[model samples]
Target: MENRPKVGIGVIIIKGNKILLGKRKNTHGEGSWCYPGGHLEFGESWEECSRREVWEEVGIQIKNLRFGTITNDIFENEHKHYITISMISDYESGEVKLMEPDKFDKWEWFEWDKLPSPLFLPTINQLKEGFNPF
Candidate 1:
């Protein structure tokens, strides 16, 4: 097996005072909540990846996406990861549905003040600290 830092992109899809979250499925953190996102494809732009991830994970099309945050982490001594960028979008179209039904158990919109406990760590950090991607 090869070792390399995995890179990903995510988005905080905003609507009014709420954000969209997906319930994770089939992983160690099964049932934990997280924003919509995933790994970038080879040669894909960040914006394109973000849009693709949102659609792939949530079955929605988003617009007015803007940069929000970047996160870096190292895990279990050897596994490293970088969330190169996270975008926030004000507009989304289509009914909410799980594109990868096995990967995500469900989806919901939640008020920021009333988010579920034990969110995906990187997302929780970004929400708490208000990251600026300048």
Candidate 2:
């Protein structure tokens, strides 16, 4: 098939001293915890993608977005690679809704250091690079 890195956008919505995350299912990083995000559509700006993904994944709104970090995630087993761009934002409003029940089932907030185990590749890579979404 194709052999190029896809641009993925990840949003770290901040609420109090916690960040939002979900347990992925039926995807490359299945069973791993990850932030709300997805592929960046063509013609979409980084900020646009961040906000869209967050709302699409979980019925919530975010604001005060700031550039966070990026990670070159290569899922060797899945034969997929993504240039994951992370964005940090403050939780503006709304409740967490499992909008995509097939993709994710559980969504919650957690302290960065107390994050759930078995995080997705992009998340692990970001952490390794000393990403501090504070």
Candidate 3:
């Protein structure tokens, strides 16, 4: 496989004082908690990818998009690399429901300091850098 860092987008949808997150399933970060996001598709802008991923993952529309944080996540055990760009947005509408049952087991909002354990690598790195969208 060609060694190239894939571009990923993570959207931190804000609702009140909580952020949206999901427990990953059947993927590289299986069992870890993560934001709604995925690989950036070809010819898509950062905001476009952010919007698409959030909707595709959890059936929500987001507004007030702003740049949040970036992390170079290297999953050594999985032998995968990703440059993750996190975007912060206000939850515009729609109920938070799992759109991809195969990829995520649960979706919920959590306070920043009360996040679930075994967070995805990009999330872990972002938090370590003290990146907070709140």
Q: Candidate 3 versus the native: TM-score?
A: 0.97
List model 2 lDDT by residue over 90-127, tens digit each: 99999999999999979989998898989999889988
Q: Which stretches of candidate 3 lie over 4 Å from their true place?
A: none
All models, RMSD in angstroms: 2.8, 0.7, 0.8
Among residues 3 or more apart in sequence or in different chains, the pairs in candidate 3 whose N, CA or C atoms overlap within 3 Å are: none
lDDT of 1 by residue, 65-108 (tens): 88787876444433455554678886468888878998988889
TM-score of each: 0.85, 0.97, 0.97
Query: TM-score: which is higher, 1 or 3?
Result: 3
Candidate with better lDDT, 1 vs 2:
2
Candidate 1 root-mean-square deviation in Å: 2.8
Instruction: Compare candidates 2 and 3 on lDDT and give the better one.
Output: 2
Please, what are the lDDT tens digits per residue for candidate 3 over residues 14-131? 9999999999999999999999999899999999999888888899889999999899999999999999999999999999888999999999999998998989999899888998
Which residue pairs clash within candidate 2? Answer: none
Deviation of model 3 at 27, angstroms: 0.4
Clashes of each: 0, 0, 0
